[model samples]
Structure formats: C-alpha cells, structure tokens
Target: MKVAVIGTGYVGLTTAVSLAMNGHQVIGVDLDEAKIVKLRQGISPIYEPGVEGALNQVLNSGALSFTTKLAEAQDADVFFVCVGTPEAADGTADLRYVYSAVAAIEGMQQAAPKRRIVVIKSTVPVGTGDQVAELLSGCPELTVASNPEFLREGSALADALAPSRIVIGAGDPGTSEVVEELYKAVDAPRVVTTRANAELIKYASNAFLATRISFMNELSRLSAALGTDIVTIANGMGLDSRIGPEFLRAGVGYGGSCFPKDTIALLQLAAQNGISLGILEQVRTVNATQPVWFLEQLQPFVPDCRGKRIAVLGLAFKPDTDDIREAPSLAILQALEEKGAAVYAYDPIAADAVRQKFPNVSYTKTAEEAVQGAHAALLITEWKQCVELPWEQLYESMAQPVLLDGRNAWPAQIVKQAGFHYVGVGKS
Candidate 1:
C-alpha cells in the first residue's frame, strides 16, 4: 500500500517509517521545512529506540520518502492524519492542527483519481472523526476513519510494528474494510467499532492508566505516613491475579505527551456535556499534587538548599528517550532552583534537551560527574543507566551522601550499605 502520513511528530514519523519497513511505500508530509529536510536526510526529529535504524533501512531501500507539499497525497492509497491535538485553555483539545490537516487533505483531493481512505491516527475527542468527515464533505471522493495510535514514547517503533491491537472505527462497512486493509501487516487483535467508541477507547485507556498511577502515588503517601514500605505492598498486590501489576509502581506522577493532557481533556469534555467525572477529577488532582508532595519530603533532608550543590539524575519522563515534555523532573528542578540550589543534572540522552529548558543549571556528560561535590542527589527519572549506577562510588564522591530515590529503582539494602542516607518514597 502507498501511504502518506501527515504531521511528522513522534506518532507520524514512527508510523511512516514502520509502515515503509513493512513493504509499503510511505511519504511523510510536514509543514516544517527544516524537519522535512532532516527526514529526507534520514534523520528522525524525535528520540525513539530502533526508529533511526528502521528509518535508515527504509530510506536506503527507497520505500520511504518525505515532503512538505500536500500534493504528495495524490498517489497515496491511505492518508493518515497524525497531527497533534494539544490541550486548549478550557481543557478541551485545540483542533487547529487537525483542522489544518483536513484542509490540506481537501486541497489534495482536487487532483486525486478516486476516493481515498483518510485515517485519523491522532488522539482526539469522541465524534472527532465525524467532525472531520463533515469538514471534508466538500471533497466528494473522501472517506474518514478513526484509527487512534497507542504508541509509547520510548518504544514507539516496536509498539507500532507489533501493536497489542488494531482498532478501526468507520461509518460504513466499506470504510472499515479499507481502514483494516491498511494495517494488514500488523499481527494484532483487530477491533471494529463505531467512531465514537474508537475515540473513547484512546481517552479511556490513557485516563485509566493515569488513574492507576495516581492511585499508587496516593497509596504511597499513606504508606509513608504509616511508615510502611510501598515496594513490598506493591509486590504483594501485584501477585494477585486480579490486580496484575502494570502501571502500579508508585512514582512521582504520570507525565508525558499523552496521559496528563488527555485526562484533562476528557474531564473537560465531560464537563461540557454537564457530566461530572469526580473520580477522574481526583485522579488529575492527585497526579498534579505528587511533585509538590515530593518536594515537601525533600525539604527536611536539605533544609537550606541555598548555594548547595544538588545533583538531579534523569530528565525524561521515562527512560530510553529524550522527551521532557510534562516530565516531573522539570518541576523538581524548578523547585530546587527556587531554593537557591546550584543544580547539576545528567541523563544519557536528555542532557542537551534539558539544557534548552534550564540554561542556568549545570549539565554534565556522566552521572558520576553530576553527583560529584553535590550535597544531595535526587533520582527523578527511572532510566536504566541511572538505576544501575555505582552507588558506593557516587556516595564517596558526594560531599554529603544523601540520596532521594523518587522512582524506587534502587535496592534499599544496597543503597543503605553504601553508607549513604537513602530516602525512598513510602519505604521506612
């Protein structure tokens, strides 16, 4: 199948590259000339594991290409709208990008030979595909279908290639079949549903996952108050066949491109319909409050952070990628700076990106360097490299060997044996 993927963000780029590697001819379209140029040069704008290699393979094989012009859609059997739907001030999704992409698709339809399948891969509110269908009604030879993507940031390429399921929501059987055929290479459970259900699935999945994380964080708070170990509690709870642990690990909070914004948008959407989602509203509140709670815990350990050297390990929300958008680490860094702490941070891939956000903070090449001469260390992100660091060596170099394990990635025994004052969430 010849496919044209619009908006070369993380989802769009991964979708295009993965599909091209699966023997489809793919043309990635973006309005940003610089990004398009880089893609043509076989460079990925976002950091995702295995994507650059797959993109290289596809580009070398001549199956993948990129362009800024919307005319490239003329030869495409399927057009995927992967643009962003950022949160508006009212907590609803700002659909400017989606609307712009629809306009471009309508313009390209002028020269197309036959009706083309327009797949909405961007996460949007329920009934969005219907709105898109109405928008493109001017183009008679167009069919819109909702095919929401569920790719995680760190493992986007792998998830795209081997998704857990493929969902297609279309108005008619013909539209559903056309959308289904485009994902013929993906070996996953196929779900066919109405457009509204498909849209709600994306929001509900993200919102539920966010709720779980918030629930665990809230439990961690109570566990800490009672001087109980959350790790042990989590381990025991995970053994239950009914609970089955995933996203149950207690941490700072859930933050990324998806969960925070999507949950808020869903809440706002419910509000607009005069429905109050009280549980989801609390979920959002709990998640937002976690960083502040974490900061409060650290205050007693480092009473006066003024002029103190504070080392922050990990910047990305999670590991294996350099995405800091809505990352909890940002809040921690800001809180540290406000208290006059001279912060030194390090992440394997997020160092440069973090520098862009906090130019005043010191950045180092190695984790050891960041910890050296520091009064305290805070583990914000659970990156594998940061998790497996030589704690004893780090302890020896620091002026004061005080460690705050935010993600609970380190072994309590090992960290305590290293002669450092180890503090972990919900662990006594």
Candidate 2:
C-alpha cells in the first residue's frame, strides 16, 4: 500500500511513520519546507517518544519519504488528511486546514489516473465528512472517509499501531471497505459507522472523559474539606467495574491541543443544534477554573509573592512530550509572574516550548537546578523525572521549604521528613 499523509504535525508525521513501518510506502506532505527538510533527515519536527527512531528506520529503509509538494503524491493509493482543526473564537473547530487539504487533493485527483481513498485523520465536528463529500462532489473518484486519530502525545507510535478502535465513517460502502482493508493490520476493534456517528464518537469520547476528570477534580475539593483522599475515592469507585479507572485522577485539569478545544467545539455544536449540553459546559467551566483554584491554594503559604523566587516543576501539559498548549503550568506561571514572583521552571523535554511562550521566566536543565534559591516550588506536571527528584536536595536549595504539589502526585510525609512544607491537593 502507498499512503500519502498531508501535514507534518504530530498526527501526520506519526501516521506516515507507522504506515511505512507497517510494510507500506508512505510520503508525508507538508507546506513547511523547514519541517519537510528535517523529516527528510530523519528528524521529527514534533517531540514524540520513539518517533525519531521509527522515522529514522523507515527513512533509511526507503519506505518513508517527505515532500513539500502535495502534487508529488497524486498517485498514492490512500491519502490521509492528518491536519489540524484548531478552536476558533466562536467556540467551533476552525477547519480551514481540512478544507485546504481536501481542495488540494481533489484538484490533484482531476489530473491523476489513480483514485485514492481520502481518509480524514483530523478530528473535526460531526458531519465534517458530509462537508468533505460536498466539496469533492465534482471528483467522483476521490472518496472521503472520516477516520479520526486517537493518538496521545507521548505514545503516538504505540497508539497508532495498537489503537482502542478504528472507527471508519464512510458515506459510500465501497469506501468503507477500502479504508477497513488498509487498517486490517491493526489488531483493534473495527467500528464501521456513518460519517456523522464516527465524528460524534470522537467528540463524545473526549467530552465524557473531560466530564469524568472535571467531576473528580471538583470532588477532590470536597474531599479535602471533609479530610478525604481523592486517590482512595477514585480507587473505591474504579473497583466497581462499571466505572473503569481512566482519567479519574484529580489534577489541575486537561490541557493540550485536544480536550479543551474539542469540549468547546462540542458545546458550540450542541448550542447550534438547539441543544444545551449543560454537563459538558460545567466540565469546561470547572476545567477553566482548576488552575486558578490550584494557584489560590498557594497564597496561604506565601502571602506576598512580590520578590519571591518560585520554582515550577514540569512545564509540559502532562509529561513525556514537549507540548505546552493550554498547559496548567502556563496559567500558574502567568499568575506567579503577575504576583511579581521570580519564576524558575524545568521539564525533561518541554522547557524550550515553554521558553518560546514565556521568555522572561528562568529555565533550568534539571529539577534541582530549578528549585535552587526558590522560595516555593509547584510541581505542575507529573513527569517521571520530576516525581523521582531528590527531595532532600531540593529542600536544601530552596530559601523556603514550601512545596505545592499541584497534581498531588507526590508523597507528603517523605517531603515533610526532608524539612519542607508539603501541601498536596485533596489530601489532608
């Protein structure tokens, strides 16, 4: 199989690499020349674990290639539109990139003899495939299918090869079968449905997960007031089997390119259809305030943050990826800066991403270096390296031994024994 992947972001690049590794010739197309050049050199533009090695292997094997020219991949058997649909100001998904990709490919189809199945790997609102179908109405050979990606940031390759489900939303029966045949190699559930249903599946999945996390986060506050542990509460409920343990951990909230944008898009989609998703709205509301609430808890430990040197551990949204889009650490860092605190931060791989957004804040190579000479430290990201830091060494470096565990991912008693004031969320 020959696959043409449009866009060189995390989704497109990973898709290209995984396909090439799975005995398919893949050509990744992107508008960015610099990114294309890097990809040709076996250097991934985005940070995903094991992607560089996988890309290098495929590139060396001559199975994977990248090009800035979309017309070059006109003869590919399958074209995956792995572009981005960022959130717009009106709370809807801005699908300009998707439209552009479709338009570009449809135009190419007119000149090419090969008819490729165009699978939309980008996450879009429901009925987006219908929109694509309308756009490609002139080109009958170019069949449109919605195959939304569920790749996590750090585990892109792993998730791509072994996904939870491969939901193909195809308006045409022939198109669905062709798309399924390509994905038959993946050992996961094959969910064949209409284009609209598959689109809703992706949105509904994110919305439900967001609701669960937000519900647990709000409950974590009540748990703290009643001197209860959120972790134990989550465990007790998870053991029920009906409520499986996933995204149930109480934390600063979800922040990346996906959850926040998708939930808002869903809210807008519902409102436009004369429906009110009150629960999802509340989910959004709770998530927006979670970082602020976490920041407010730090006020008691340091009344006046002016001239206070604060260290922030983990700048990435979660961990293992250099992605900081809507990261909790960004909001907390902005608040600390506004309060006139000298902020120092460190992440295993995300410091450069954060540095691009916040140039004034100090960045360090190591967790201990970030905490040195700091009045207080807030552990925002639950990175393995950040969690396994030398607590006693950090205590010795800090001017004041105040530790605010934003994710509540640390053990309090051990830090207390190391002579630090440890405050964990929802843990009394």
| Runs with alpha carbons beyond 4 Å of true place in candidate 1 | none
lDDT of 2 by residue, 1-428 (tens): 88999998989998898888788888999999998999899888888899999999999999999999988897699999999999998989999999999888887888775677889989999988998899888887778899988888889899999998999999889999988888767889999999999999999998898899999989988987899888889989988889998888998888999999999999999999999999999998899898888887788889999999999999899887888998988888888889999999989898887888899999999888888999888999999878887887778778999998988888888998988898777778
Minimal lDDT window, size 10, model 2:
107-116
**Structure candidate 1, residue pairs in collision:** none
lDDT of 2 at 141: 76
Root-mean-square deviation per candidate: 1.2, 1.2
lDDT computed for candidate 2:
0.89
Q: 1-428, model 1: which lDDT tens digit per residue?
A: 88999999999999899889778889999999999999888888988889988888999999999999988658898899999999888889989998899888887787665778899999999989999898888877798899999998888998999998998999899989987777788799999998889999999999988988999999999999999999889889989999878888898887889998899899988988999999999998998889888878777778999999999999999998788888999998998899999999989888888788899999988888999999988888988877888887888899998888899987779989889888788787
In angstroms, what RMSD does candidate 1 have relative to the true structure? 1.2
Error of 1 at 24 (Å): 1.5
Error of 2 at 254 (Å): 0.9
lDDT assessment of candidate 1: 0.89
